[model samples]
Target: MSDDLKVTAELRESFGKGAARKLRALGKIPAVLYGHGTEPVHVSLPGHQMLLILRKSNAVLELDIDGKGQLALVKDVQKDPVRQIIEHIDLIVVRKGEKVTIDVPIHLEGEAAPGTTVNQDSNTISLEALATAIPESVVVSIEGAEDGTQIFAKDLILPEGSSLITDEDTLIVAISIAQEQDLGEETDEAPAEEAAPAAE
Candidate 1:
């Protein structure tokens, strides 16, 4: 959180769907910044620059607005699926040391013990971490784990200034036996009935 992300932004003069379409046509994204009990400020950002900076989830953005500096957090983003472009974004003003709950992805590294398969039911863990220093993701080691072994939220080791916001017993990952594939020809399992001798 060293203010590594900086973007050039300007005050949005016009507002509405038509105005937004015009901005998009000009390769700019319409955005709003509101938080900390301040009035929502409408602005426009460079589409390319904003996309690059938003590569990281919960990105901390430093906005240079008309030569003034503003600290903000990426709270929401709206995008077009087909075009893969940023349509709009919402930013929340935040200060250092403020806590926020966000989902940190779970990274499972290393192969499980021989004959044991890894089942990842939870890919991200919800935790309360500093808005400024929130971790990019959470790493859990399943190395040499045996079958039926489970790792829970309470067992996670958080870095300083971070706290567990999710349930303690929430299962994150477990080691289990792999399912065997059925490769044989399919057949109906209903048993055939025996016939009487010549209907006697």
Candidate 2:
């Protein structure tokens, strides 16, 4: 299941650090909405509400501003390192039903074959999906994969309403034999050379 997020925003007229700090004290998050060739709009959103909606990565927000509705995609989130609070957020205006390219996390699942290891070449891949229906992430399986086996972007199963924008040849992940396992092989034959005599 997916998360449904809606945020209410008020048109903001003030700008700069002073106004922003003041807004923060009142638990409002200063934000800007831009993109789709429209002029930027400054607004203040409820901080608590925005935080709840932002917990999910790549969240799509339905912004209700003065009874006006618009589709918004999270572009950037500024945080205060010390407080771990969201200082500001940038939302890109998007149209419903339009495909926008974004990176979705790649989830590694299942264990590889015994004595083998898995190495992820890419953490995420860009995909063109419906603005209002963007997926949370892409999942790939490595169940019982042996050494030298590789998973490519094209091999991923995209969620409904999502399409791959990355190159089909791009390496997504790979599995290989563990070094210790390879070194564990022993020889039956004993060494021909004699060891040096123990010190007297």
Candidate 3:
């Protein structure tokens, strides 16, 4: 794991909504770590630092729990609906080189052939990858793709250590001829109708 992914966490003994609110007031986030048949551990993490790290999807954190190191994969995040503030987080313990299944965002690159519009059917796909080696996202290039061209999940080129877990037949991107609107014809017809009403 990179040094930037490391965070020092404090074990928290408090519970309930009141306790969680207090932690957030102090710029801390409450999180639970559990997995591998171990009991769940509750801890508090720094708010600002976590927000920065979590901006990227499927973020894995190297947590320092009282000078002890542990690897955790971000499982879920709860946020305030209106404020969009991070409320709590769930982390799953993972071992080095362990394979974990997660969803990776899809990123499109390049433009399709001229006069063609590209449509993405799915925004993210599931993948199985090493806990620490998960790719941030998968890229699908539509460069020079002609109309009627389609790309499926099976056709995607994944990162070296990742394998696609999504259904093989899922459509990822489709390129088609752009539909043109006949605005000029509509305008001409509207003026004729108005002129008829005026003559009557």
Candidate 4:
């Protein structure tokens, strides 16, 4: 389940690349909050804390903005390609018990049968769960699975109060026998007579 962490945010008046750079220099991250039929609010959030909170998937936050508490869901995060530093974030407001559709990662546990390889076809599956109850990831066991075994989306056991939103026939994991290619045999060279004739 997603845990809501409290964070303090200050309203930001500056905009554009220059302003964002300044905020980053001061260890603040620029972000926008919008939802619940209200106008978008621009603010600056603490950089280190924001990065830590965002390490979890589908992070929820209880924002304290001037003594007014607001519930927000992590919607999007943009980052620098080389430095991998967070650039900006977009948060969507949500209420308790609100149902939201999100994609959760599939984690395969255990090993398949010997001489077989497990191939994952889908990395994520969509689910409809409560805003605060969204799972971090779904775990599927492949223990002792034999070759030609297939696990489909319809067969997934979802967490309580969650329902699958992805297609039922989606292929999640497939187990198959490992194929080995045989290298061609080396041929013997018909050798030295031609070199000796050329030398003569």
Among these predicted structures, which one has the highest lDDT?
A: 3
Give the lDDT of residue 15 in candidate 3: 100
Give the alpha carbon lDDT tens digit for every residue of 126-156 in model 1.
Answer: 8888887888888888889998899999888
**What are the Cα lDDT values of the candidates?**
0.84, 0.87, 0.94, 0.90
| Residue-wise C-alpha lDDT for candidate 4, range 136-182, written one tens digit per residue | 89999999999999999999989899999999999999999876532
Alpha-carbon lDDT of model 1: 0.84
TM-score for candidate 3: 0.91
Can you give the lDDT of residue 84 in candidate 2?
89
Cα TM-score per model: 0.86, 0.86, 0.91, 0.88
Q: In candidate 3, what are the lDDT values of residues 1-200, reduced to their tens digit? A: 78879999999998999999999999999999999999999999999999999988988899999999999999999999999999999999999979999999999999999999899999999999999898999999999999999999999999999988999999999999876656667876998998997998
Give RMSD to native, each candidate: 3.8, 4.4, 2.6, 5.1
Clashing pairs in 3: none
Question: Which tens-of-lDDT digit does each residue in 47-83 have in candidate 2?
Answer: 8878778777788888888999888888999999998
For every model shown, the clashing-pair count is 0, 0, 0, 0
